[model samples]
Target: AQTVTQSQPEMSVQEAETVTLSCTYDTSESDYYLFWYKQPPSRQMILVIRQEAYKQQNATENRFSVNFQKAAKSFSLKISDSQLGDAAMYFCAYRNINNAGNMLTFGGGTRLMVKP
Candidate 1:
């Protein structure tokens, strides 16, 4: 079974500063998808970024990017120039490459607190 792990249970960042969240996973499949999701106080799950295992280049969206290490099965998210709105619970999710219609298996989640 594939599993996702987030070493940090909670994290804090000053407004306008950057922070990186650590995540690692164990998967037997060579091709799969890794994702970072953000859940705010509202509890809505939002996709922060996604990286395909087959892609060598990392994925970036706005102020978010990932360091995907397929060999090590490590996928981390970096939040650059963070803002107050960035405060949320960040989760690492895994999806099978072959199962397109299946839902994602998520990590416990890392709660991000933004201080002004």
Candidate 2:
């Protein structure tokens, strides 16, 4: 079983600036995947980035990046050059590598507000 936590229910960032959203997770499995997902007003979930538990390097996608700390069980997302399109509900999730259904355990999402 896995449990993820997003301490900040909401976070605000200025346009063109940078913002970091915090996430912590608990998992008994040694091999798993950690991810950051973005859901806009349309409710479509988009994969922001992914980190493998065995990998030490952080995951980065374009303007999005993650600070993944395996020991601390932390996976925080850092949005660089924030834009209006980046405003959305961000979720931290995870799943065992061998999951059959690929079902993901998600954290209580954090709403990101981009201020112009």
Best by TM-score: 2
State the displacement of the C-alpha of residue 100, model 1, in Å, after optimal TM-score superposition: 5.1
lDDT of 1 by residue, 56-79 (tens): 999999899999988999999999
Candidate 1: segments with Cα more than 4 A from true spot: none
| Model 2 spans with C-alpha error above 4 angstroms | none
Tally clashing residue pairs in candidate 1: 0
* TM-score against native, each model: 0.96, 0.97
Q: lDDT per model, in order?
A: 0.92, 0.94
What would the TM-score be for candidate 1 when compared with the true structure?
Answer: 0.96
Positional deviation of residue 114's Cα in model 1 after best superposition, in angstroms: 0.9
Worst lDDT window (10 residues) for model 2? Answer: 25-34
